[model samples]
Target: MSETTSKYKAPALERGLDILELLSEQDEAISKKDMVAKLGRSVNELYRMLAILEARGYITTEPESGKYRLTLKMFELSNKFPPMQRLLNAAGTEMAKLSEKTQQSCHLSVLHDAEMVVIAVQDSPYKMGFCIRLSARIDVHGSGSGFAMLAFQPEDQRRAILEASETPEPVIESVLSQMDKVRQKGYFIGASPQISGVTNISYPIFNSNRQVEAVLTMPFLTLNSDSLHHQVVSFEESRLAVADAADNLIHAIGGCTPE
Candidate 1:
């Protein structure tokens, strides 16, 4: 079956939520193998979700027993995520509009340490399009999402954000060289360094505090010559549209463009 129509998608997400709900009722560590059995799924099926949970600190592993257990960190983060939730709620429709207008998929990403975490995505209405996985972590130095976010932050914060990254020296220098150009243009258009035949166009979303909180991106694809959607909009069209959409969302969430 095609990935978009696969029955695995819904249940896989259900399984991730199920793990947290099950663990919240337990007081002790549970083995991975046992969780597998309790989950009624193969280890391979649960591996990715479990790793994401562990990395995000919703669960912790015991070194002695190598078992997993719930942590209060998720609760702590839940308290701080209301604003983020608000942004997603406000931006959803606008993002869908962007996809409809540009015939390209777009995603919203924010800095998490040195990585960019995709928090929201809207797929193009076209039969075929790019879509980034929500909660996916992207390398900050080599990605357009990273460049948009990095270029907009104030100088001090920019340095700190860059310092946290462990990108190769050549890549770091390249990104540094591109910062001013990106800021001057007020958007970034770069080759998807990791994905072939895709262009990642990114713009920053600012808040009333004048802080660039998130990057909004459109991964415009190079369509097959025989593709259904011909005469797709140019990169500049997608760029300008996303910039306006980002600004609208910023205002929707009580933010303003930085001066």
Candidate 2:
């Protein structure tokens, strides 16, 4: 007689929901190892779900830090819920206006669990625009929105989120060193680490709970010009416009932005 070995099985749906729930409780983001310990699931089981979530824009991984977090697409879906429709409707108008005014792609994204998913994007009036995929997700470490979300979190919680990532320890350490400045600046501006030539600036959106629930970002290309003086002036102007629009968006959304 031949002996047989048993294989382990995981409940796919249950595991996905469990991962979301565990992440929800965290103020910062959580790492895969921490998830394994906290959720008591195997690494293979966790990686499968994480891959799905990351692909679906439900979660994002920070490239520099290799951490994962929830995204704002969650709020967009939740807006379909009867209780949230009114606020969502109101925010949509403001999002559109901001996009028009800035002449750069504008995104209204919210955090679901620990990820920031794009709920809305407004195309710029300029022929050259940053056209992002609808519901696209970017990691909390690479974009302005991620910085905004990370900045608002409590120190201990933020540290946990940073430490929880699968990123090599050295990379995490280097990124954490700059986090303090990000927190103090209230927003961030830089080129897209994921995509070449795209520059972006973003600010946090807060809910009644005073927690960062979402982010509004303006992504555009820095036009290459032979006239260095003109290029410098244009960049400065665009940055100011984006900043003003972000503040206006915060006021327009009020407490319903998310928490």
Candidate 3:
């Protein structure tokens, strides 16, 4: 059949994007009827669009409820692009400067496998702070970096991550108890449980999709002798710096960017 005469010649491209955009805006899953009503498309057309989106891994539907929501494809697509590299490149020099300024170790982390994984780090010249390893997996309930990232996650996803953390049950309960404290303070501050005399300062990084995609962590300890015992650095300054840098990076990579 001629392209213009074919019933299957619907605007597949537009419909697919529409589905993604619509799902992203919704805080909860939406029904097919609601989707068709909002998209102003016929039932058949919406069904076809939803099918294509699901097959492409861009959207998901409840097996029993038939409700739809956005999938992790958004994160996968963001990672597939080179823009994250650009963020690192743009901020690498600045990160060094920050470490030098504060005389403290600095690190960057991104959410992966529902855990906060360190992707970059700049150690302090003083050697007093914990040295973070690249690709280290941190518990969402324990580390300062993990708490910073988890604080910004969607409620359901956050709960799931915490539930699945490998941390001991008692520690998990204590961390959960302090979540409100973390949120109210806009930071997680405490002595390092894994390392003595180490302080952790961390903040989340937002992506173009406005999802908390990563975190920047700083570890430092006072160089002064008997500086009031173990003192972890506060996150106030580092959070602002990471937030600004992340905003710039997101704007740069709003769409895919070349190396």
Query: Whose lDDT is greatest here?
Result: 1
List TM-score per model, in order.
Answer: 0.70, 0.61, 0.56
Candidate 3, superposed: residue stretches over 4 Å from native: 1-80, 127-129, 225-259
What does the lDDT come to for candidate 1?
Answer: 0.83
Give a tens-digit lDDT track for model 3, residues 110-161. Answer: 7776677777877876555557776677876768888877766656766677
Ranking by TM-score: 1, 2, 3
Candidate 1 per-residue lDDT over residues 114-199, each given as its tens digit: 88988889988988898998778898887999999989877777767777776766767777788889999888998898889899
**Which parts of model 1 have CA positions greater than 4 angstroms off?**
1-80, 224-231
- Please name the candidate that would achieve the greatest TM-score relative to the true structure: 1
- Candidates 1 and 3 compared by lDDT, better number: 1
lDDT of 3 at 88: 71
Compose the digit string of candidate 2's lDDT tens values, residues 28-80. Answer: 87788888998887999889889998899888877777777888787668767
TM-score of 2: 0.61
CA lDDT, every prediction?
0.83, 0.69, 0.69
